[model samples]
Target: MKQDRHVSPSVINRLPRYYRFLRDLLGRGVTRISSKELAELMNVTASQIRQDLNCFGGFGQQGYGYNVELLHKEIGSILGVDRLTPAVLIGAGNLGKTLANQVNLSTRGFRLIGAFDKSPAIIGTDLVGLTVQNIDSLEAFCRRYNPKAAIICIPKEAAAAMAGDLISWGIVGFWNFSSYDFTQNHQGVTAVNVHLGDSVMTLSYLIKHMDGFQEEAETEDDA
Candidate 1:
């Protein structure tokens, strides 16, 4: 199915969550589900689910709900989850090690073909089955594998230079965990800047306001 170019970014952002939920459904032997059922599971409204899926050329039926496997596959396809784009991690530090090892990169759209770091002590060490090559060897490795994506976990100071190097070296997609924002300069490239601190701070805000939010909702219902 062709993608809707006019789809909102908010809808696009929800695709991964939809894909994940559908995958879970498939794993649990759920062969079919209605929009209402799905919404209940996802903490959303049935109409919202219908609108979002419809934006992608609605695969559901009026009476039969959605075929779970088909919906999963379609959402996965839409997000390129199964593309297995060749990817590399640029930092072999604590965060990098966790991501490369703990995360199932292949199942989540990337294949971590290489890991790199600037430290001499870390060089030649094993990281998620790949040897930690010195950052100097990055270009040579890129030439050999021609990776389309890179996972940047290095420090903020190094991210700017690394982003330029990746773009010039033909890497088009980035999963950046550095404290730097790489999206500002790269106009056409696909970049997701993962600010770990920002996320935690945002979580703090939600936690701080949760009680008030629930009280407001309760008051609204009573009114």
Candidate 2:
């Protein structure tokens, strides 16, 4: 049955939010939930949820709602959050240390099991609960621990070399925080570039548009 079930990336992205909402509803002792309720919580149309779920085969009745417990289990299993995904960090700088400290990764199926760095000063230091092992140990660490994913926050100049090493060590998924372009190794790994400057620019654009919209709304409200 699991082999027959197919999930698109868009559907995969929404599963965690749905799972969290279902957990909240269950805590409130709610048994059944309508598609419209889910749509409202996720700020999407009711038909969208229906369509996404229908892709995996229909579950709810025509008038009645979905089973809260069953939906939770289904979404959890689909997103791979039911079991822990071993993860590691490949730097010990400020950005790397901050990512290492993030606790919500486990709830989303990722666990920060270890970290590495080139600095002798930072190496052997404890980052949260995980120690900052030397960079020389990277290959051995990956082979031994077999992490499902890794976060790369090394310097821009060092990122490509590190990425090459990671690929050689069988790391296919990467959350790259460096400023370098990973175009060369794009085919070999799943890389997510966290560009802080680009993110700030996006925020500024949203804030400008939002301010104009608020002004228009206030004018209409006064009229």
Candidate 3:
């Protein structure tokens, strides 16, 4: 594994994919996997797989390959899956509610300790076992829970202010889906901006290009 502090973001992004695939292998009762086999499953070259894994540390043996469970545990440790990071959710709107209900934050290292919203209709209501508190109570709640991260699901206009408030309360990271670019304004905060519309547009572009590719292939076959 590469020991350098300046690991590329692309490598960082691929770590989660490796972790997920290892998890699936574990579920299937697979005991071990070679770099070549794993690479085939992930659709990457074996050398690339080795390079990415080397960024952390070598886990595989020369001929024995990697012990599936051990490698999975090591990758999970690297990814901080066991950190149980406390997090708060701002905005108890549709997206926020869906995330709370459907997503298992703990599986990914985060624990949802508080959920807040400005709307009186949402505030004081139960959201997936946690009561939605008034936005006015965010600071107090943050102080009490001491969350390390905040999940922003509010409108674009309100996201920045909400992020500022969370930052004041000692939040160091944000998972933002508000269509606002938090990192552009916040200099030192670790923010993951989720743009659903952009992802859908990308899918549309791929579908259009795929159709064009199929037409060209068919024409060549006809010739």
Best by lDDT: 1
Judged by whole-model lDDT over C-alpha atoms, candidate 1 comes out at 0.71
| Model 1 spans > 4 angstroms off | 1-82, 178-193, 199-223
Looking at candidate 1, the ten consecutive residues that score lowest on lDDT are 214-223
Question: What is candidate 2's local distance difference test score?
Answer: 0.65
Would you estimate the TM-scores of all the predictions?
Answer: 0.46, 0.45, 0.46
List RMSD in Å for every model shown: 16.2, 16.4, 16.4
Q: Please provide, for model 2 over 1-223, each residue's C-alpha lDDT reduced to its tens digit, 9 standing for 90 to 100.
A: 2234666789767776777787678768888889999789879899989877776666677889788888877776766754766777888888787665653566444667679998999998988656689988888889997776666787666776666666566665565553322221324432222354444111110121121111111111110
How are the candidates ranked when ordered by lDDT, highest leading? 1, 3, 2
TM-score, candidate 2, is 0.45
Error of 1 at 194 (Å): 2.5
Per-residue error (Å), model 1, residue 195: 2.8
| CA deviation > 4 Å runs, candidate 2 | 1-82, 178-193, 199-223
Off by over 4 Å in 3: 1-82, 178-193, 199-223
Q: Candidate 3 versus the native: TM-score? A: 0.46
lDDT of 1 by residue, 1-223 (tens): 3347599899998997898788678868999999999999999999999989998886999899999999998887787755667778888988888777776665454667789999898899988556799999899989887877777788766776676777777776564453322232234432233455534111111111122211111111110
